[model samples]
Every structure is written in structure tokens, then in C-alpha cells.
Target: MLRRPQGNLSYVSGVTDDPLRFVTLSQALDETVAAHGTRAAAIFSSEREVMSWKELQRQSDDVAAALLGLGLQRGDRIGMCSANRREWLLAQFGAARIGAVLVNLNPAYRSTELEFALNKVRCRVLILARSTAAGNHLGMLRVLAPELDQPGAKPVLESRRLPHLRHVIVLGEGLVPARAERFSDFLRRGSANGKRRLAALAAALDPDDAVSLQFTGGTTGAPKAVALSHFSIVNNARFAARAMQVGEGDKLCIAGPLHQSLGLVLGVLTCVTTGATMVFPGPDFDPLRTLDAVSRHRCTVLHGGPALFQALLDHPELPEYDTSSLRTGIVAGAPCPADMLERAVQLLCLDELTVVYGMTEAGPVTFQTDVDDPLELRVATVGRVHPNIEVKIVDPDDRIVPVGRLGELCVRGYSVMRGYWEDAKRTRDAFDETGWMRTGDLATLDADGYCRIVGRVRDRVLRGNRLVCPEAVEALIRRHPKVQDAQVFGVPEVKPEGRSDAKPEGNRGEDLCAWIVLAPGAAASAEEIRAFCRAKGEAEQVPGPVRFVAAFPVTASGKAQKFAMRASMVREMKAREIKTA
Candidate 1:
């Protein structure tokens, strides 16, 4: 329930009878294992691997012991770059078991991104897959650290580029680098003595200790590392599990990337807290495999972003599989359209589908609709504040706004991140004077405390003195009969003929561009969409350019990359200018 202390102010706190859990992740996992030892903890459908709770506990202990054998200490950072797989979970829990922080590195990252993240966090150890559907992850590491190519090099890597990176553990069967150790060999390094050390470390672990570093989506700039504590994520998962009504025997098919908090905290940790079965459809999200897993395993819950759900809904072979087993799930990582939610309910049999709103910094979830909420409430709003969380909407001056007025969303509570990892300046800027973490999202709160996200503050486009919100435009465009999906962003304004690059008195220096993905067998021109938007939306909300594409460039977690789209549009505009000259 939401409590409003200041009448008409956009401030609300979630009041719940359930108290927050004070245990570390390792303790939470142990408690679940004690109760559901023989139950299936995880099932990798594509790999044909199933691990019971007892087995998961045993393997994670071995992982912890191996890290101890390698001379890793508490508060050290261990990076893992891989797709969704069993090793990901093993490494996650293993790192927590020894009080080490796990830095989740996206498998899609190349040399530059990978190097920056590892060096930023000062990672001492990295565990990565040899390859993924994205590309050769190991090859990128080799390019970043040429020392790995040297024959007869020691197990510890010594590189100038990645100075803090001392060890690289590679998974999958391949020609292992001389300086890098194979994952299987690394696990064997665990012994009875190392196990004793791991047990001792686990016993001394604190719930407030940082256990994970999640990088932001980097849509606007370089990604900031958000540090999360054991207490924050463990309680977050427990509360989320309660909201979805997850139980011990429930099976969840989680398709989001493990690098993001959506997958690791909400998907993996939720299962650990609830004693539910975590099901992976494949190493990476495959709609066919997901459908098959839901039918084959009778998965009770499903989780994915809007794009993933759309892929599943639009797949040609969707009707061939049974999705009736799916009852509840989360639609997050991007703004979800009402039509998509309705379609998912009718087609995917997700009667209790809820929309969640959060960022990587807020332990990944601050607001989520209840499973029993009406369809209109579920589709229109991101729901009320999460349990044990305080939320408020503030204007530019950081003053609280009136209810139902648009402003920046600020959050404070146990679920808020400890801070941006090791960056004091950014961390200081993330919160207000009273310690409310600024969420950087434009939103409005109703009297009932339901939050309606308008868009990101940085995402608003300035065009000829008029500010246009892309989310509003995109929502209007998606209502068109021919459009299946749409992403709106701002590109550099093309100067009129005979005008210089200098900004004129009234110029805003940006133009709105819309990328549209048409419905199957649908054909529409750019003018058609612009006209439709002009008819239904305000003048400032109508995009100038509309480009129809098969799909939008998205992050691994399925959020549309508006920055990438803007870059592509700018490049095309430059090409056109050169041609005209």
C-alpha cells in the first residue's frame, strides 16, 4: 500500500507488513537449499542440463573454493562475460559465497567496451565463454591483451592494457591460451582446504557488502558501474517473488541477458529466494526454444523485454507450441505498448502479465504491477512503489511536485544501489541532499501512487524551440494499424540550402526521426506515418523523418538503442549532403 504524508505532493512510501530480509545472498541460497534440496534449481534446456538445489549448492561451493585457491580476497572484483548458461549462475553464487563482487560483462561487448569495463572495475579475475552467438568473446580479449598470445606464459596474465586483470578463465572446448586457464581446470583447483576457507569466508560475509557491479545500458554515454549489496538484491528478489506469487514448484523461463539486473537479480535471484525452478530456453534468447521450453517443461512463469515478447508473439511457429503453461511474467527494459500487452495476454496465455519500471542502479526494479491488477492498470502504469521503498517526483530545482504532474522520479530505500562503483563524483551526483537517488526518468504519480513514465530526461528532443518527447511520439506511431513497433529519437538537423553550420537565433539544431517496424504484410510510406502522427499527436510530437526497418538495433537486454539509431541517421544525412554538393 502507498502512503501519502504530504497532501497533493508527488511523494509516496510503500508500507508493507513483511520486513526486509537481512541475510546475504549465500545465506538465502543455503536456506532455500535446506528446504528444496532435491527440487530442480535450474534447467538449461538447450544444454540438456538440470541441477538440483543440493547440486547447485555443491557446485557453487566448488566455485568459491576455486576462487580461494586462486588467491582472490573479499571485495575483489570477478568479471563474467557469457551468455545465459549454467556457469553464469554458478559464478554469480560462487562469487557471493566468498564475498567477492561479480562484475557482469555483456557477451556482446567488443575489445573497447570489454577493456573499459574490466579496467574501470579493476577486475582481478575474468570468466568468459570461448564464443557466443554475438561473436568470439575470447578473440576480443586476446586483442585487448596481446600477452595472452605469448607461449609458455604463466597462469596469471600480465598486460599493460588491462593492468588489473591477472587471470582469465575460459569456458567451452577450444585451444586455450597459454596465459588463460580452462574453466574445467580452474574448478579442479578446489580442494578440501579451499572448501574450508570458503566456508569460513561465507560465515563472515555481511549482507551490506557489495556483491555485484552492474553496468548501465550506456545509451547516452559511457556506462557507469552500479554497485549492489547482498541485502538489496536478496530482498528485492523476495519482494518481486511475492508480487508475482511465485512458489517452490514454479518453473520460470527467463530469456533476458544475464549481464543485466533484469536477468541476474530478478530472474536468477528470484528463483533462489522463492525456491522456484530457473529454466533457460537457450544460451541466448531464441523464440522457438523459449516456446518449446514453456511447453516441454510446463514453465509457470516467463520473463522478457518488449522486443523478446514481440518476437515470440510474431514467430511463425508460435501456434505449433503450447504457451498455456505461462501464467505470470514481467514486461520491462523498455516502454511496453498496450496493444502488445493485450496480444501477449490472448496469445501467450500470460493472464497475469505485469509491467515493471526500473534502472540498473535501483537494484533494477522500483515499481511493478501486481499480478491481480486490472488489465488497464497493468498496461497503462508501471504500478505503485515497491515494498520498503520511498518514491517522489521532483522538478528541476529538486522540489517535490504536485500529484499528476510530470517530473523526475527519485527513489530511496534499501533497494537503492550502494553507489556507482568506485566513482565518488558520479555517485555523489546520483543522489539528492537528503539521499534520494535520482532516477533520471520523467514520470507522473497519481493519487493512488501509480507511476506513469513519460520518458527519459536525456531523451527529449529539441526541435526549433519546441521540445519533443520520443516516447510520446513512439506511442502515437505504434497505434497505427500498419506499424508493429517504432523507435523515435533526435538526429542532427540538416541545415537549409545556403545556410552555414552556425546555429541561427531560433534553431534548436535537432530533428525528430522515427524508425518503424511494420506489421507483417504491411506496407506504408514515410509520409503516411508522419500524417498519422500529425492527425493524432501534437505538432511538436510529429516526427519529420520516418524510416521503416525490419527491426531496431537493441541492447542485449532488448532495449532499443536510440543513440545508435541517431548515429545512423546522422551518417545518412552527411552522405546526402555530400551528394548534393
Candidate 2:
């Protein structure tokens, strides 16, 4: 249901792109950097080399010059496998500034995952981050080097590991192996001291040009390459800053991994656009280290995933740290149990906490809860869409659903991505023929125009000829006092005792499976939980038995992967059936 807004496109800022068509991400970056003198921006860190805005600007310039000097063209892919160090951001912004498509390589990715991503995108230059205490990154890259450079496998010059990877840059304080070049060496060769050849590299890039190939962490199998033009991400940052009310001199602490879209735009680019100071914990986020950074930086904002915030709250020594500086930022990825929100506001003493709703392709968009919203309302909704973004609820017949009814949430606007890189078929499938991106989410828009998510349409169960939403169980479980977090999914009914055995186990069709993380020291049995749900029961609402876990498996983006849980539950059921007499 589209709400009648007090304002329309005129309410948006810095989004006046070419009126004739859509602009890309590269175009936006060029404009933003030029707007703020490159010499004026800086990324602070604890390391020996603290980069000034000028140094960062010239370094990116030299990096882009080095990249271009290698003859990599506009459409060529440069894959990066690094953690959240300053160099990672430099490589990313540098590549984007050069009009070369930057692929954010996940450090958490094993060689198998990296192999799939690299080969899929024909990446020409590979950047690797050295190992850190959080994980062994460089070791993993070395193992995969053979597949990447080993020669004769492709039409490139010679046999090398990662055959398609012509150049590999390491961002670490270690000696480069015979196979790869250190980022320092590359920069040194590209330029002497602070001088830069920015003219050719800084040519006005088109808004529609391909700027990045971010991989979508598919809930099913291997991740797919999600393409974002300069405009898609830049516009998202521009609108998001307005949505969050970010201003100059604001201090931001980034807790989410920069590799993902939520982190990239909100954590990285938002600071760039607003002239905000961003303080990042070393490569991987450490809960203890994060608290330290907050205390020292006197952080004004904290944009974190639910997992990071939960872990912070769960820490036995939480009271020892100084968290009084936090004020406003986004909290999402996992469902923020209403209790977490209260603790954040009362304990962390934050001024505002917004729950963002969107994935990589769409950027960090669709809905955002207002900072001043009440606790329950904040817990229940992802809020309203920004001015430049358009959303609709459509039924199976492609008609828009009535207000307050659940339907597939679709988005159409500047934040929508161009398409999947090199995969037109998936790109076509992702959007309706008319161009609205199918969000695969089941949500209802209230009379007030705020949308409350009902469930993920992709996670629905076909129960006795009707679709049952698992999110109903999630909402119900969260209502319990002891339950800290809940994620629900359906297990397809198996023909117990074989298809020929008859009577199909009770005829309710499919069963619901819920994973619950309880509050510390609290204990509740399944029967008691079932009683709670039964008390709140409504017609046709399929409430499932709750399963307790110390912690749930999650993605890099901090989202619970229910598909894995579903598969594991199937195996557990099969084993139970075998053990029964």
C-alpha cells in the first residue's frame, strides 16, 4: 500500500542525477570526492600508518593509476579478499574511482567460496589480506593461488596460480611471496611520495557504468554475483544519511563487516559523504575490542548487526566498559529482541536506534524505523521507505494487494540494483517484467503507511492447501519473557512409514521448527512454551515446537541461515524415526 506522502521526490537531497535516466555508483563517488576535497577526508586507525584525507586521496589515486597502468579496462573485474583494515577501504574506493568493477571478497570465505566468486567474475587483479588473530586469510589465499594463477588453463600469458589473476596485492606487514606483489610495492611503483596522475583516472564516469560486483550470499547454495552501478550504492548512501540525519563531525563506530552491503554503505560510505569520522576495530570485529574503540573514540553512533550487539550485551564483563558515548545508529541482521532494544536505550544510553530492512542488491533500503519510535513499534516494524524509493505489495495475479494485507514486497527506485553481473537471466528473474525488484518478503503496510514484516515469502510452508508464514512463530516466540531471540522455518512433511503405509502422520501437512536462544540463567521447557503459544493462538496459525540452541548458525551479514537449520532438523527427524521401536 503506497502512502500519500507529505513530500515526494523534492524531499530527497543530492539525488538530482540526469533527469533523462538513472546514474551509476561511480558517477556519485566522483562527484562526492570532488565536492569534499580528497585531501580533506581521513580514515583513523591504531596502526603506524594513520592516513590523512590527502594521503588517502593520493593513495587511491596512485592505486587507481597502478590498476590502470596494468591495462585493466573499465569492465575488468578486481577481486579483493581482505578484512576490515584501512587498506581494504582504500582498494575498494580506489577501484570504484577508477571505473573498474570492485568485487568485495569475503575474508571468511574459504578457498572454495573464493574460487567460485573469482572464476565467476573473471577477476583480473586479486587483493589478499594477511592472516589476523580472528582468522587465517593469507594462508587460505595461498592455497587457492594455484587454481587462480597456474598457467595454460586460460588464454593469458603463461601458467600461473589463479590463471585469471594477473596481479595479486597483499595488504599486510609481511614479505610478499614470489607469486604476489605487496600493496606498498605497487603504490611505490605507481607514484613517488604524494604525487598522483589523477587526470586520466578521474575522467567523469557515467552513472550507469558497472562499478562493483558484490556477491549475494544465497540462502541455498553458492553465492551469486550482485552488480551495483555507482548510482545504486551512492544514492543509497545519500538517502540513508538523510534518513539517519547524519551530520558533519559525527563520530561513527562500525561493528558490522565492511564486506557486506549494510556495512559498505552505512559503515563506510556514509562517513565519507557526511564528513563523519569512522573508527573501525581491526580486521575482524572483536566484541571486547569494539567496546574499547567506543570508549576511546567517545563514539556518537554505533551501526551494528544484532549479533554484535547481542554478544556485547552477553559479555560477562559488560559493566566494566564505558559505553556512555553511543547515541544513534542502525541495529539489524538478526531480529533485535525487544529486550535488546531496551537494554541498548537504557544501558548503552543511545539516543536513537533504527532497524534497517534490505539486502545487498537493493542496498540498505526499503524500510527504516524512526529513531524516536516506541520500543514495541520499533521491534515490530522496519518503518517506512525513503522518499526516492518506491515500494508496493503485490498478489499472485500481479495486482497490488489491499492495505493491511500480506503480499510480496517489491521495490522500484534509484536504490534498486542494475542487474547481476554477467548473469542476465538471474537479473531478469530477480525483477518483474515491469522492472520492480521482487523482494521475496511477505509484509503488510499499515494504515499509517509503516510496514510490518510478516515473514520471508521464500521461507513459507504449504500447509494443507494454504500458505503458513513461519514469521508468525518468530513473533509469537519473541513475546515470551525468557526467549531472547527466535528464528522459525518449516520442515516439509515426510510420508512416515513410506508413501504406501497410509494416514500421512496426522494430516496437518507441514510442521514448524523454531530455534530459540534463552535469556541467561532462564529455563523453560517445550511444553510450557507450547502452552504460551496455545494461549495466543489464532485460527490457521501453525505454531511449532521450540528447539533451544546455544547459538544459531549465521552468515557473514549476521542473518540466521534457516535453510541449514531446516536440513539439520530433517536429519535429526530421520534419525529419531530409525531409533524408535
Query: Which is the leading candidate under lDDT?
Result: 1
> How does candidate 1 fare on TM-score?
0.93
Q: What is the TM-score of each candidate against the true structure?
A: 0.93, 0.86
Q: Encode model 2's per-residue lDDT on 11-67: one tens digit a residue.
A: 112123323224444344454556655433433444523454556665676777777
Instruction: Give the residue spans of candidate 1 off by over 4 A.
Output: 1-6, 462-466, 481-485, 491-511, 515-526, 545-581
Q: For residues 1-581, could you state the per-residue lDDT of candidate 1 as single tens digits?
A: 35542589999988777899899999999999999999999999988889999999999999999998899989999999999988888899999999999999988886888999999999999999999999998888889998987876368899999999998999976678899999999998888998987767899999999999988877766888999999999999888888899999799998878888878988999999999999999998899999999999999999888889999998999999999988998998887878889999999999998899988889878999999899999889998888899999999898899999988999999999999988999999988778999998999999888889998888889877877878898889989999988999988777656767746536547888899999999999988898998899888887877799998886544557888888899888788778766
Per-candidate local distance difference test:
0.89, 0.71
For candidate 2, the lDDT comes to 0.71
For model 2 the TM-score comes to 0.86
* Model 2 regions lying over 4 Å from their true place: 1-40, 43-45, 48-50, 147-161, 191-197, 316-324, 374-376, 478-486, 494-508, 515-529, 536-558, 571-581
- Cα RMSD, model 1: 2.8
